[model samples]
Target: MLTNRNILLCVGGGIASYKAAALASKLVQAGANVQVAMTKNAQQFVGKTTFAALTRKPVYDDVFIEHDASKIAHIDLADEADLIVVAPATANLIAKLANGIADDFITTTILAATCPVVVAPAMNVNMLEHPATVRNMERLMADGVQLIAPGVGNLACGWIGKGRLPEPEELVETLSGLFQAKKLENRHVLISAGPTIERIDPVRYLTNDSSGKMGIALAEAARDAGALVTLVHGPIRGTLPSGITTIDVESGDEMLEMMLTHYDQQDLVIMAAAVADYRPTVTYDRKQKKIDGPLRIELEETTDILRTLGERKTTQVLVGFAAETENLEHHAQQKLIRKQADFIVANDVSRADIGFSSDENQVTVYGKDETVTPYAQQSKTTLAQNLIKQFAEALR
Candidate 1:
């Protein structure tokens, strides 16, 4: 898939630098012209000779190399590449790129490049969570750089957290996805995600166990397809996918308002949020004191956002989700018909491993023609990709 692509691989100073050598070989095997640039400190972990052997090219590491005015290798190398990849991007290098510090050849070429840049960060858990590093990462994202998130596992620093670099094959797959012409280019997608909170008192609320993993996966998949995606998210702790515009909200009412404001602008709308069906009529401003007796509360129905949007939708594709414990297909079909949604994704939430907070899900999609497609248990990310692919085909 990456045939004839020019890839400049930047290896930074980290314990994960050894992975870069394997990554270079993988890229080369995939028919990419690979060039390696290494930081001086990186040599301690992985030798420059290994990279040279893998890529069959001279490893660039100096700013004052063979010092001739016409032989400015950094600029030349930067201009010749189609994509720049930084594996094991240490906190120092990320800060340097974010702050435009070009004291080294790698940073200098990064500054000089005009193509897309992808970074895989690897460091101590504490360093990854540091405020400065987080800020720098956000800055890089705003600048259109793509980050392949670090895997969570045992780190060299004796910490167990998310600081491990993704495997070499995964990095190569990410690069391939980035360079492939996006299938959903110029499409506008609006997605609602997470479980909405319904307040009963200042400290008490009604919510679900939804972790937003499915919705987040869908957002990431849509973004990868080159769609202009706006994610209306409820209270969830998952990371927002790179390149998506996120609007965070706490309650179902707020989510509804955001969706109403943006839905008209989209060609597709997916209502994946698990909104509260009922809420306390009177929400106390302060925490209510619990008595040693049963408490009685007046409940009212919340706004049906999908129904409202379905009523207003004209040519836009509208999709809804149903999490049911009984009569799943019957209820989902009724929801699809009643809400006027084009399709309903229904799943049995009673299965502890298949729904709500789980990383994997199994769902059945009901279409207007009563056609049901069953999706077996799989990672939410993979399921999202499948859903988007089907949606894109329907759009076409």
Candidate 2:
């Protein structure tokens, strides 16, 4: 997907600098032409030679050096880049970027670049939470910089908390998605994801294990494909992509309502959310305190969102997700027919590594003509792009 794409990798001064080397290599393996730029402090962690060996291009760290005037190296690099990525973006670097301080080569190129900029921050938990750093991050976001938040884990500073950089594989997947062809350009896509919460009381509610990662990924993928995407998301812990419009909902009925209102505007509809099959028949406005006797609650079925969309679908392609643990194919095929969906993506939630809150998934796509396409286990982001590719081809 990254074929012929140019990625300017700006390495910042931080202990996570070594991860940048792996990031560069991963980008190359994924068919991107990578150019490495580093801060002077970054060299203390990873050598310039390593970046050169991996990218097969001279590492740029000095701004005083002169290149051809007509083809100024920094400006030329910025002009030609499809995307600029800053991995291990230290506090200082993030601040400089947020404030437009171009005292160095990395910041200079960033200031001169016209492409999308993505920054993955890595620092100690204290630094990450510092008011100055937080303010700077907010400024960058306001200025249209995409941030991949640091993961939470053990840090090099011996403190166990947030500020760990995302793994190289995940970063590679994100970058690849950013530069993919805009197959869904000029199209509108509506996607629903995550589990809806039905409030039993102010203090209690019913929901599921759905993390909404897959649905969010689809929204992002569709947006990257140049589609105007709207994600109707239930209560989810994961962050939404930067540019897509999001509508938050709390119950299956609410989701259905939102979908019905916006469904007519979409060229494609994807029902990936794990809406509650059953909701409390009666929801109490106030908290229900602990009762001495056993408590019982009546359950009622929620609206059939997918079936409704399938019935209303005309030229728009409707996709549904079926997560089954047993008789996966049979169940999925039945749902595909019953829901009148154009395609149904089925996965086994029995596996611990994929599906339902997991980072990876392997799915089988069942088309209306009984055709099945299987995909290997991959990150939700990658899976989303693959699905969008298939959808785009079907449209063509």
Candidate 3:
């Protein structure tokens, strides 16, 4: 995917900076036209000659350098770049980038670049976990920046936690995924993810084990495929990539409202949320007393978001998720017919290894025409891309 592509690699000042060099070498070996740039502190750990030798391009650091007689160095590099990557992104440097600070050669070039930017963070455990650092990362994500999450292991600072840059080979794979053709370009997609909560009282509510991983994966995949995605989700522990329009809702009603609000503008809609089947008939203002042996409260059925969308949709391609422990195919087929979805993605959530909060998923996709295609277990990230590819083909 990197064949003859120009990559502007920005190395930050950190012990993990060596990994950045390895990444540059790998990119060069993969047939990419690699250009290396570094922060002032990075040159202290690795010499500019080391990078220039690997990429075979003059390492850029000083913005005022007279190497280019006709063009400005940073602007020229920015214009030539197909992608920008920052490895070993220290908390300090990430803060600078998140806030659009252009004090050094790397930051200045990044600011000038309009291409996609990937940030790989590496620092001490404490620093990585700091509120300030988390906020900065969130800000960058909100601005559509993609992130390669740091791995967890022993740190150079004697702290044990997540602060390691991913391996060079992994970085290369991620870049390849990003550079794939934007097949869903100019398409607008609406997705609902996570488990909605049903409140019985102000202090108590019923929820599920959904971590919103699959839905998040779909959102990222759609975003990468060049679709304008709007994500309506329940509470989540992690953050999605920067560009998605995200909305937080606690109850199934709220989710339905948000999805309907954007329904007309979407070319595709995926109802991935595990909404409550029933809600309390009468919500109490305060916690209920525990005096009685058994609490008898009436339950009411919630709105069927999938069925409603199918009934009201015009040209939108509707997809629904069916999480079942038994009779997966039967349930999936039933949903495909009853909900009028174009495709129903059914999964065996009974398996402990894949589904629910797991990072991986195994599913059998049922179509409107009674086709049942099973997908083997794989990371949610890869599964999402494959699903999108299939869906894109199905659309045609």
Among all candidates shown, the one with the greatest TM-score: 2
Q: Which scores higher on lDDT, 1 or 2?
A: 2
Predicted candidate 1 versus true structure: per-residue lDDT over 1-396, tens digit per residue: 689999999999999998999999999999999999999999999998999999888898998884446768898988999999999899999999989899999999999999989888899989998999989987887677776667666999999877888778767866786676677898999999999999988889988888787888788888989899999999987347778899999888999999999988898899999998988899999999989989999999999999999999988889999999999989999999999999899999898767687656899999987789899765565578778877777778
Cα-based lDDT at residue 363, candidate 1 = 96
Model 3 steric clash pairs: 141-242, 144-242, 144-243
For all candidates, the clash counts are 0, 0, 3
TM-score of each: 0.77, 0.79, 0.78
Show the lowest summed lDDT stretch of 10 residues, model 2. 64-73
Model 2, which residues run further than 4 Å from truth? 1-5, 12-33, 53-56, 63-76, 87-104, 119-177, 350-352
Candidate 2's displacement at residue 274, Å, is 1.4
On lDDT, the candidate that comes out on top is 2
For candidate 2, the lDDT comes to 0.88
lDDT per residue, candidate 3, 201-221, as tens digits?
999887888889889889998
For all predictions, the C-alpha RMSD in Å is 4.5, 4.3, 4.2
